[model samples]
Target: MKRQQPAQIKGLKKWLDPVYSAWTSIATHKLRSSLTILGIVIGIAAVIALMSIGRGAQAQILSRIQGLGADLLGIRPGMTMAGGIRGGFGSASTLTLEDAEAIKEQVPYIAALAPTFSSYQQLVAGNQNMNAQVIGTAPEYMFLYNLEIADGDFFTDYDYQRGSRVAVLGANVKQTLFGDEPPVGQQMRIGGNIVRVVGVLKAKGAVWASPDDAVIIPLTAMQQMVTQPRTSRGERVVTSIALKVTDQNQIEFVTQQITDLLRSRHRLAPGADNDFNITSVQSTVEALKEATGTMTLFLSAVAAISLLVGGIGVMNIMLVSVLERTREIGILKALGARERDIWGQFLTESAFLTLTGGIIGVVVGCGVSVLLSRFKVMTTLLSADIIVLAVVVSLGVGLFFGFYPAWNASRLDPIEALRYE
Candidate 1:
């Protein structure tokens, strides 16, 4: 045991000596070392900041999509191709109220559904005038969309059957037209037709499909006031239909059943495309998430180009370092230091420089992210895992870029280096 003690101490010194020598060399050339580290700092900070913004955007979009409920399904008119040109989705007036009724009666596991249409119209209340989206839907729309009434009541089935000219105001519409005054019982003109305001909806902030900026009226009332095309069988064309599945697990099955029924009703051949499209809310959410993820990866890759530039800077600085310390390397080699020792020392020096820069970059990046979120300039999400990844990548870059210079330093001939003035 006593004889082995000296050998263990020698082995420990072999590792610690290189680290100490590397630190001493770096400390001796503070200005040059700092300049080299600046490149790494900029690269890391850019990567972290851009990644945080991407992640935050993805989260916000997902939250808005999921707000509509996971068990919801939407049916909309498909695209139309005319003269070899394809129009955008929802451009064709293919869906109808009869199709919605058929789905309601035929499809199983459907808790509720509503046929609806919308158009932007000019609204006038007393002396106030503004343009807002006007939605025509059945009485079941309230339940399907999870809307709540803050004043008065939503129109009833009797009003819908009678084609009553009553309307419901969204929070923004009411505030704009009445401004602190109660909107119920007041009259508003929609497209030059006078309609009575029977109810007001609660405020639901900004969302993808929120009715906060829209007005709701019975479908029959809108059909009478607006000139819309009808099917050959006298069915009124509708914009879209919203369906609520009774069970989240049954969404796929319900979608399939609706598709088969609609295809049969439209008399579409087996090889032909249906005139309508059915999209489940869950599927839409997944698609959006995937798109956002791809965008984030693309932006991160662009930012990584700067890291590569920083690695090149590391290589350049290490090469200059090898040239400046050639005589010192010769003295160490003559004093019994091995080539591996010289290699390890230079590699340690390069790693230390990058590792220091990475820590500072993380601090700067986090501060910038917090400031952006604080001032509402943009949203940002910084996770610990990303920080760890940035640091590890910086270390790996140092080792990779430092290889050639370290090898050149280790292979120097003692006589040649000693004579190199």
Candidate 2:
């Protein structure tokens, strides 16, 4: 007669018997199991929380930059470099209002462009006096920057043509000068020149550039009343030109055209570099992505170290478990349990421990993320992919660390294991 098979077990219920037994064994030593799982829980939670914070920072930065305008380009003065290093600051007179007018006349893709001139001046309102940066720009500045009026209206073409002493109050400037009182129609002294506040801009919130910190006035008024007297060279000048492109896709083309035109006008040779720097949304986005990528990598590495420690803890605990269960292992072996069955039982126990910790970790990480979002600190976008990945990694840690102990237990001789004290 053939040797009787060990009771012909079948179906999922039969396969789960060993798993159930392993779980019971772990439950008997509740404190030890909970402590072992706590390490994994903390580690996985750290990984998820840190990664979410990094991603949130990236999103916030990108949103702020894009909020300025996707189709805008900024031109500032810079040196022409011959070799690897920069020579020095380029000519101060490189960019001019004439160039801005030429671009408005020549480039069809250019929707609007404004020449900006600025200075820090003491602004006086009744008995209130505060020093703030004053920006000089044409009426078109409002449209180019998407600045909206909270009260009254922006200065018009007639104001620019007449060179009127009209000003627009930035959000913070209004608060400083008038508090809760309406600033529209109020006359304020800027550099001893009285200018009427025709418009008060709505609060734009604090942005990276902080536009709310400056006071805006007609370009002509600023050039004549504020800037010309201070210029030793006696040249009425503007600092930089901000341009709004008709289409985002045409930014590169328009930027190149503007560069070539400005270079030619500035008497730069074909081989010589231009005297102005052009900043576009695309360039800003690329730089931000690179910086954020570096930060993510660094944070991930730090979190990975925690995960490694958790893995080691699991391995150590599993080894101790094997030694503690030596008699139990021998009893099963003596009852004719196969080596594979012993391995399966231990592996299941280890996986269940880690899986439990991982589930709890995901919940805690997401809870923290939600709290952060509520406080307007950052966003935590916990997608299905990340959740699945966390689970897989947790299970992988259990399997990887549990293998050695499981194998060692499985290889024990039945007679020796039976005699183990």
Candidate 3:
């Protein structure tokens, strides 16, 4: 037991000796050590801050997409080609109210469906007038679009069935038309018809075709105002159809089933191109996530360039340190210090410098992120993994850059070092 105790004590001393020597050397040249640490600090801080911004942007995109309802699927009429000039999606009136009804009856796993017609129209409330996207849809549209009433009640099925001229206002539209005052019970004019405001929707943030800049009315009422397109069988034409799935897991399956059913209903020949376009909110979210993830990785890589610069500074300083301590290394060797001891000490000094800087940089970076979010400049998301990455990266840079200097110091000749001035 006594023999083993001596060996353990020696091992402990060997490990701690290098750390103590490194600290002493750093303290002796505080200014130089600080300058070396400052480079690492800036590098690590830049990495953390830029990564935080990238992550925040990714989160914002995800939030906005999820806000659109994960189980939602949007179907729009496909393009029309005339004289070889192809029009954009929704230009052709290939879909009808009967198609929507057929899907509601045939397709399984459907929670709710909304067939809609939309057009740009001038809305006038008192003397306030502005051009806004006007949507004509049923009450089910509220569920499919994930809309919430901020002020008043949405129109009911009774209002829809009777084609009552009731309207719902989006947050931006309400703000522009009525400001802070309640807009419910107010009357607005659309085209030549007068409509009563029934509700106001909450702000959903800006996205492609933002609902915040739209006004909603019953589908039947919209047909009366606009020049309604009709099928050969006299079925009313619709611009788009939005449906929600009962189970989020069944979204892909339901989407395929909808495609097949729509193709069959439209009587398109086999292998022919579809006259409709379908978009899955879940799939869209995944695509956006992939794009954002790539962007975040790119931003992180750009920020890491500073870390390379810092590492070069560390290598420069370490080489200078080795040159200045050549005589000291020789004296230690003459006093019976081993080569490994010198190597360990210099490497420990380099690692300690970077590790300290890494910690300080983390604190500074977190402070910057908080300030950005608080001031509404940008949103930031910091995770435990990021801090761990910073520590590991900083330590890695030190070890890699400090190697040559540590080796050079360790290889000095004891006789030559002892004779140095």
Listed in order, each prediction's TM-score against the native is: 0.89, 0.85, 0.89
Q: What is the lDDT of residue 383 in candidate 1?
A: 93
Candidate 3 to truth, TM:
0.89
In order, candidate lDDTs are 0.89, 0.82, 0.89
Candidate 1 residue-wise lDDT, 1-421, digit = tens: 4655588789998888877888899889899889888888888887788888888889888888787788889999888899989888888778899999999999999999999988899999989999999999999899887889999999999989999999999999999998999989999999989999999999877467889999999998998889867877778789999999999999889988988998898788998987888888788889999998897888789778988898899899999999999999999899987999889889998988887888887887778877988999988889998799989988998899888899999999998887778
Model 3: per-residue lDDT, tens digit, 31-149?
99899999999889888988898999999988877877788899999999899999999898899999999999999999999999999999899889999999999899998887889
The TM-score of predicted model 2 comes to: 0.85
lDDT tens per residue, model 2, 211-249: 687898888888777644222334344678899998888
Model 3 score (lDDT): 0.89
Ranking by lDDT: 3, 1, 2
RMSD of each: 2.9, 4.5, 2.9
Q: Clashes in each model (backbone N, CA, C under 3 Å)?
A: 0, 0, 0
lDDT of 2 at 341: 86
Best by lDDT: 3
- Report the alpha-carbon TM-score of model 1 versus the true structure: 0.89
